[model samples]
Target chain A: MAAFIQLFVSGLATGAIYALVAVGFMLLWQTSQTINFAQGEFVMIPAFFVLWAIKILGVGFWPAVGIAVIASLLILGLLFKRAIVDPMLKHGVLPLVISTIALSIFLKEAVKDFYSSQAQPFQAMIPSEDLNLFGAVISSQSIFILLIASGAVLGLNKLLNGTRLGRAMQATAQNPSVARILGIPVERMIMYTFLINALLVALASLMISPIYLAKFTNGDTLGLAAFIAAIVGGFNQVRGAIVGGLILGVIENLAAAYISAQYRGAIPLILLIVVILWRPQGLMGRAEERTV
Target chain B: MMDFLTSRAFKGRVFVLLMVGLIVLPFFLRPFGLLLVAMWMVHAVAALGLNLTLGYAGQISMAQGAFVGIGAYCTGLMTLAGVPYPIAFLCSGALCFAIGWILGYPALRVQHHYLAFVTLAFSTLVFLVMRNEEWLTNGIYGLTDIPRPILFGWNTGKAQDFYFFTLLMTSMLAFCVWWIIRSPWGRAFIALRENPVRALSLGVDTRRYTLMAFAMGSSIGGFAGALYAPLVQFFEPNSFSLTLSLKLLLMVIVGGSGTFFGPFIGAATEVLLPEWLRIAQGYYLIIYAMLVMVLMMFCPTGIIGLGERIISHLRQKKISSERSAQAQAMGQDKVAQTKSDTQGGAGQ
Candidate 1:
């Protein structure tokens, strides 16, 4: 029971991070109809930025995060989205995807060249004490990560549900042409979606960087897992990303503990194949039929 | 000039030029260069497979590297277990063909981006399996000392001999690809890519043809991997990482997807471009990434597409100029007739 609880709590924390990444994917996919393969790079690059600020520039944590978020919004959200994805969108789905993959390669390689290719330590903003809850010893960082991740989700939900800007974004996603006719600035809304995705990924990166070192390859693994999470949950739904992420995280933890550690990595792939085969619409996704 | 260049006779001339280039290429380069050429052929085999799925079928598959790795390991292990190299190679292709066929089931259910992620997940799983199965694979320690291939009782252990052998295989495979692309089944694959719903409505077996393309593509991947083993003599999980798969995709795109010689051009770029850009040291990949982005932006059709565009542009230009000249002559004739009519009226 103790082992189970411990695994569950830790899994929840990891899932929250995965959920954050999945939410980023959902936002971009919803707005642009293109998957930002560089979404993982958004997290990784910002995590490195925070590392640079604190270690090289000798800044405080919050200030470092502030700088990273701004930089990510500018470089990843605006510049990358405008330059790479927007133009590639005109070509076709495959070209758009290939361009994003190219963008990811650029981000990863740029980080490796500019920053240290090796993993760098990053300090979490939260305190480092351990708390015992129902036989599970939870780290302060894990608690903080869970709170912050869930908070971001709730915050995003509120923005999407309760705000004019959120509604405008949704309207744009529903039909850009109609939204344009209705006087909603569809292009700006799409830009805002990219910015929000950047901010959310930066937040997630800051939350998880202390647990795992800021490494170039983190985005590849995390991005892949988050993509799977979004797909298994439902590519079109935000709540599905959260639910799917939690399920994936818990399953991964349980599989690692009970099953052979070697096969732990295969869990998500197995789930993905099963989910895609059994339910292509995903766990909570509405069936959408694309017309010619 | 453009018309002559695009003529069927021009194609034969180009083919003969390529044949001459292939025959004389070994003598012009050192052993290392010869080895690079051999590796290029191996990668071309894999790129051809990718082209079938990504280019011809319009299906996304980032798992080509993993499939290649599976084929390599299977052949390597079988040869170690005393199987003949040729039979082992065939077995490897068959195994990957089966895996690809099974993967096709889920592939049929998903659309473009979904299919991409599925292949990504499948590749990750293949990597995990390759890394974990120490008993069968020797795991991270990797397989070493695999004997070189023997063809017709001649040991292709020498660099030059191996190069020729790989070249022969690449040509045969390339020919097979060309035949397939020209066949009815290939047309069905392209039809699936162009319009799945319409193709299905038109009596094409979308599911079966897709599965066939995926399986055939994967078998080619396996064949490439099998040939790859004898060339390198040792490999590990690192050689078949997702990065390698991405590189294969890069080759296909960079060389121009779907074109007959596109995979070869892509394979050559993958094998040789790095050496040319090696002076940049740490910045080579960054430069390469930027190049790919710029290339995709400006020329999404790859190298072959660029050539086609140039030829077509030239043809259009020539035709438009000739039409203008003819119009000028007609205008002069009308002016002459009008001058005669005006003169006659003045005389009256």
Candidate 2:
């Protein structure tokens, strides 16, 4: 039972990061009508940015995090405009999808060549000591991650529900033509969605990198896991993504603990297949209608 | 422009040129180059299979690599078990066809992105199974010493001999694919791509056609893998990975999806360009990735589209020049007629 609690808590911590990434995907897909296949790269590259800030500039952790987030937002926003938004708007979805995949490859290769291909250690935000609670041991870092992740989600929910810009973004997402006709600045809103997505993924990377270590390939794994979370919860729903991430994280952790570890990597994919087959609308997603 | 490409004489010329190129290509290249060309042909076959699904039917899949892997292992194990090479190859293709057909069942339920993920998941699962299943796949140590074919007393042990044999097989499959795409079923696939609802209304049977496309495409992938296994003589489980699958898809897109010669051109570029760009050292893949992104951005049609664009642009220029020449002649005629009228009036 103690082992179970430890596993469950660790899963929640991991799930929090996945939830962040999943939310990024959900927001991007909703606003842009295209998913960023390079999202994993976004999760990965920011850690390297933070690493550079810390190692090269000799900055403190909070300062490095700030610099990394700012740089990533600007660079990714510009790249989103040039590499994705422009061409994607012109060519449509398939080409955009292909380009995103290319972007992913480019990001991976760039990090491998420019940054160290080897895994780099990152410092945890909190103390490295473990906390004992009711026969279960948890790290201070895990608690920190859970708290910050939840806070971010709550903040995001409030912003989306209460703000004018957030409502405009939602309007654009629902119907871009209508939003544009209503003078909602649909393009700018979409761009802001991209910016927010980049920031979210970078934040996720920063939060989890201490435990996972900053590796070029970490994004691919975590990004894929997050994607599964979004799909399982509901691609179009924010709360669904949050719930999905936690559920997936707990299930995957339990599976790794109880089942054979050799097949752990296959667990999410298997779940994805089952979910897709059984419920295409997803567990929490609405049944959408479209005219031909 | 489309008409010119589809014209009988033009197609015949293309056929003759390709045949000549194939016959002459082996002479100029070294053994290593020949080997690469053989490998290119194998990939080209797989790309053609991908074309059937993605290019024609408009269903995106990332499982071609896994299908190929299954084909390779099935043939490898069969040959190792003392079965003849030809029978083994056929059996591998048949198995993939069955598996692909089954995969189409799930495909019927999902939308586009969902389908992509399903295929991706299926491929990952296949990869995991192949890696973990020690008894059958040799568990990442991989199958080795797979026997090459001895077709009608000709030994295919040498690189050149194997190249010719593989080339023959690739050409046969290529021709079959070409034929299939021009058939009524191919038209249905195209209809399915353009508008599935309309296709269904017109009694195109989108589901059956999609299933057929999946089955045929997967079988071709398997065939390519079967050919690949013996030619290389060794393949680790990772050889048929997501990267390879993405590369195949890249070839199709880069070469010009939905076009007849796109897969061949794409396959050639993918196989050969890396070798030529080896001077870039460690930065080659980064450059390649950038190139793909730029290509998708500006030249979504790939290399084949680039050629078409040039040809079409030239044709338009020629047509405009001819139009201007005719206008010039008409203007000159008007001037002459007016002068003649004035002269006649003066004479009167």
Candidate 3:
């Protein structure tokens, strides 16, 4: 009983991190119709930045997190404005696909060049404290990561429902042309969507770095998992990302425990494939009307 | 001479000349390395498979690596089972084609990125299967000591012999592609890629075609992997990872996605260039990326496309000059006619 509960909690914590970044992915994808394949790199690059900030700039953890998030958003602004947003505006779908892939490669390789290519433990935000809840061991970092992930999701929901900018973003995603005609700056909304994605990805980095050591190849695995979360959650749905992440997390954990640890990585991925095929709309995602 | 120059026969002559030139060009370089040549052939086959879906059917796929693995593993198993080389190759390709067909149906319903993601997941699934199925793939140890393919009692275990064999296989596939492109069905495939909705309006079943494209592409991927297995004689999970898939995509894009010789030259450049710069292994991939970007920027049409453009431009210029010279000659004739008319009038 204790083992199951512990595994479940760990899974949820990891899933929560994926969901957080996946939320950002959903937002960017919904608005721009562009999925950043390098999103995991974005999640990973910030931890490296945080390390740099602490080691070189003499900043503490909290301030380093803030600096990493801000700097990451700024880079997102530049990358979106330059390589992505401007060039891909009216280009055909193929160019958009190809260019983003190119950008992904660029960012991933750039991270490797900038950081120490080997894996390393990141600076922890909290001390090593295990909390006993229902006979399961929960770490301070896991709880913290869960809280942040949940808080971000709720915050995003509120922003989408109540705020003017979020309303405009929703409007752009639904119908960009109509939004544009109604005097909404749809292009800015799209660019800001990227900004939000970067912010969320940075937050994910801050969350996961405590457990999963920051490494160059971390992007590939993290990116793959996040993509699965996005898929199982439904590509366009915000809430589905969280649900999808949890599902993926649980499946992966169970597989790791019950099956070979190496093969465990393949579990969530398989489940993701099955889900997408069975429910193209995803668990909580809106149903896309079939054109027949 | 003018008549001959204007005839279609001249075009055939040019094509033969080009083919002959290519055939004789390889002897010019030393190292003339066969292992690298075989690698290029494997990559070329992968790129061609990608082209079937991406270039022809207008679908984006990230499953090239998975399909290649399918082929490699299948080939490995068959060789282990004491199967003949030709039978193993055929079965490898067939297995991949079946998988492609199965996946194509569900995948066809999704749009661009979604489809790409599904294939990504599938590739991950493949890697897992390859790495985990200890009985089949021998787990992480990989299937080593696979025997070299024998042809006419001549062991192709020699590096140069494998190179020639791979090159021959690539040529056969290229010939197949040429035939497909010139066929009506090929036109239908391109039409579907260019505009699926419009193609559907013309009674073309886009789903069936897309499935066909996937199958064809997977078979090519399998063929490449089957050849790849015998060349290296060792198989590992990393050999067919997501990076390989991404590299194939880079090859397609950098080589100009929709062209024929693009894959040929692109594969050579992508494979051999890294081999040549082995000293810079530290920054080798970074250099490879920058090179791809440069290629994408300046030579978006690829080497073949650029060459085609240059050839067309020269032809156009030649035609324009001929037209001008003809006009000048006509003007001279008109002048002479006027003078002759005057003379006739005076005689009258």
RMSD to the true structure for each prediction, in A, is 2.3, 2.1, 3.7
Between prediction 2 and prediction 3, the one with superior lDDT is 2
Error of 3 at B51 (Å): 0.9
Task: Name model 2 segments beyond 4 Å from true.
Answer: B1-11, B334-348
Tens-place lDDT per residue, model 2, A1-292, is: 9999999998998998899999988898888767678888888888889889988999988999899999888877657765666766668778877888888888898989988899999877777889998989988888888999999899888878789988998898889999999999988898888888878888898888888899988867876887899899888788989988988888889889999687887888888999888877778988677558
Q: Which whole-number lDDT from 0 to 100 does residue B298 have in model 2?
A: 83
Candidates' interface RMSDs, in order? 1.3, 1.1, 2.9
Docking class of 3: acceptable
Place model 2 in a CAPRI quality band.
medium
Residue A97 local lDDT, model 3: 51
* True-structure lDDT of candidate 2: 0.87
How many residue pairs clash per model?
0, 0, 0
Query: Against the unseen true structure, what C-alpha lDDT does each candidate score?
Result: 0.87, 0.87, 0.79
Residues B193-233 of candidate 2: C-alpha lDDT, one tens digit per residue:
89999999999888998898889999999999999999888
Worst 10 residues of 1 chain A by lDDT: A92-101
